[model samples]
Target: MLVGLRAMLCIVSIVAALPAHAGTLAFPSTGSMPVLSFSATVSAGRDTAPGTALSQAFGNAGLAVSGTDCTITQDISVNGTLVPGYTNVYQTGVPGIGVRFYITAGWNGGWTDASSSQFNKTDGGTAHYTRADLVVTGPVGGGTTSNLPSMFIKFTGSCIETVTATQTLTGSTSVTGNGCSLTTPTLAFTLPRAFSKNLPSIGATTGDTTLSLGLNCPAGVKVGITVTDAVNPANRSSSLSLAPGSSAAGVGVQIVNGATLVSFGPDSAVAGTVNQWIAGTSAGGAMQVPLTARYVRTSSKLVPGSVNGKATFTMSYQ
Candidate 1:
C-alpha cells in the first residue's frame, strides 16, 4: 500500500510540471518602431537699394541661400526566435524622423553710392535683406531580424529664388568756369563676422575680413584714394569732366589682408576746364556715378588677434 501511494504522488508532481512547460509555448513575440526629427535657414546674395520690395531686394546685396529644410527618422525591429534552454526574449520598436526651415531678413549698412558733382543727386542705397522658409514631411521607417532598418520613404530636396535690379540717373547742371564737376556721395559700410553665420570656415578667426569698392568713371577724369590697407591696382582710375549733356563715372576698391574695408566718409571733387574751353559758355550738365564694394578673404592662416584698417578719398581739379 505504501509503494502504490508514493507512485501516485510522483505522477501528480509530473502533471504540475507539464502545465508550467506548456505555459512557455504561449509567450508573445517582441516588436520595434521608427523615430523621426526636422530645421531650415535663409541667406541673401548682396545689398539692396533703398525703397525696393523685400522679394526684389535680394540681388542688390550678395547674400545667397545655404542649407536644407528637413527632419530625421529612426526605426527598429525585434526577433521572435529564442534558445530552447532560455525563457526570456527581448524586443525593440521603430524610430521617427522629420525636417523644417526658417528665414531671416535685415539691413547691413556696408555699401555706398558716390558721384562726382554735388549738384548731381545722391540716393542712399538699400541695406542687405534675406529670406528663409520652412518645409516639413514624413519619411518611411522599416527593419527586420535579417536586415538593418532603413528610411525607405525619406523626405529630401531644395528650392532657390534669385534676386536682381536696375538703376537710372537723371538731372541738369550749369558751369561758370571752363570745367564743371559734381559729387554725389554717401557713406561706406563695414560688416561684422556674424553676418556670415552659415559658413563654418567664416568664423571669428577667418571671417570675411575685407571690403572692396568699384568706381566707374568717364574718360580723362582721375579717381584716387588713401586707404589703411593696400588697395587693388585695378580699382584706381582716372575721373572725367561732365560734357555739356550727360556722362557716366565709376571706381572700385579691393580690401586686402585680415581687415575689411568699411564705408567712405563724406567726399568731394574740384572741377576746372583745361586749355581749349576756357572763355566759352561750357554748360556742365547732369551725370551719374556709381560706386560698389564687396568683402573677401585670403587663404592665409588666421592669426589669433584682432587688427585695424582704414580708407580715405580726396579729389581736386587742375
Candidate 2:
C-alpha cells in the first residue's frame, strides 16, 4: 500500500511540471539573432535632415518561422514615440535622430509596421517568416551609444523562442557644429620697388601688410583657424604659391599670425589638420584676429612684374 501511494505521488509531480499551454509561435532552434550595428558621420554638426537613413542591418535571417497551424500574433512596442510618416520608426536618445525595425512575414510577403504595440498575425506556415531590417536615421548626434533597448515584441500562441544573446542596437555618430560667422576683407600688399642688388639673396622677404579678420561667434566655443593656399590646396608650407596671371617669378607669399609664421592646409574644418591653431574662446561677441602677410624670395632671381597670392581661411570649433 505504501509503494502504490508513493508511485501515485511521483506521477502527479511529473504532470505538474509540464507546461500548461504550449506556444504556437516559434523562432530558430539553433544559433542566435543577428546584432544591429551602425556607424555614421555627420558634417557641419547636426546638419543632416531628420529621417535620413545613416546605416542598416538585417537580422533574424536564420530564424525561420515555423509551427503547427501557426496563426501567431506579434505586438511591437518601442522605447520612444513613433515618428510621423515613418513606419515602425522610433526616436533615439539624441534629438532629431530615429531608428526602426521593419519585420516581414517571410516568402514574398511585404514588410509590416510593428510600431503600433498591437498584436498582428505572423501569417506563419510555409511562408517562412525570414528576417527583419534595422535602420538608423538622422539628424544624427555626436558620440556613441551601445546596447540600446530600441524595441520589444510580444507574441501570442505556443512558440519555441531561442535563448539567445541580446538584440542590441549599437550606434556611433560624428557631428560638427556651426561655430562662428567670419568676415574679412580682400587683402592686398604693395612693396616699394627694390633693385635686385638691394633684395640681395634668396629667402629675402619684403612687403609686410597687416590683415584683420572679424568673427561673430557664440559663447563658449573654442575657435581654431586654418589658411588654405588657393593656388595649391595641398600646400602645407609657410610659402604660399603665386596664383596664375602673376608675372612675378621666384617669390611666394607668406602669412604670420600675430608673430608665428602660419602654414597652409586643406580648406576643411576637420580638427587636427596641418597648421590649425586655436585663436581663442568666444564670449558671444565680436572678435578680431591680427595677421601679417609678406613676400619671400623663392629662387636666386626675382622677376620684375606682378606678385599675387590667394588663401582661404576656415574655422574649427570645440
Candidate 2, residues 1-318: lDDT per residue as tens digits?
455443343444434476534343444543334566655654332333344455555565343444333444555565656555665666554554566666554344666654322233433533323232323344334444333445555544454342222344656554334456776545555655655665577878777888678888767666788999998999988999999998988888889888899989888665566788878877887888888988788888779778878888887764
Candidate 2 colliding pairs: 22-158, 23-157, 23-158, 23-159, 24-157, 24-158, 24-159, 25-158, 25-159, 45-176
TM-score of each: 0.19, 0.48
TM-score of 2: 0.48
Error of 1 at 33 (Å): 99
Error of 2 at 115 (Å): 26
Regions of candidate 2 where Cα sits further than 4 Å from its true position: 1-178, 189-198
- For model 1, the stretches where C-alpha displacement exceeds 4 angstroms are 1-186, 192-283, 303-309, 316-318
Worst window of 10 by summed lDDT in candidate 2: 126-135
Highest-scoring model, TM-score:
2
> How accurate locally, in lDDT, is each candidate?
0.23, 0.60
Q: How many backbone clashes does candidate 2 have?
A: 10
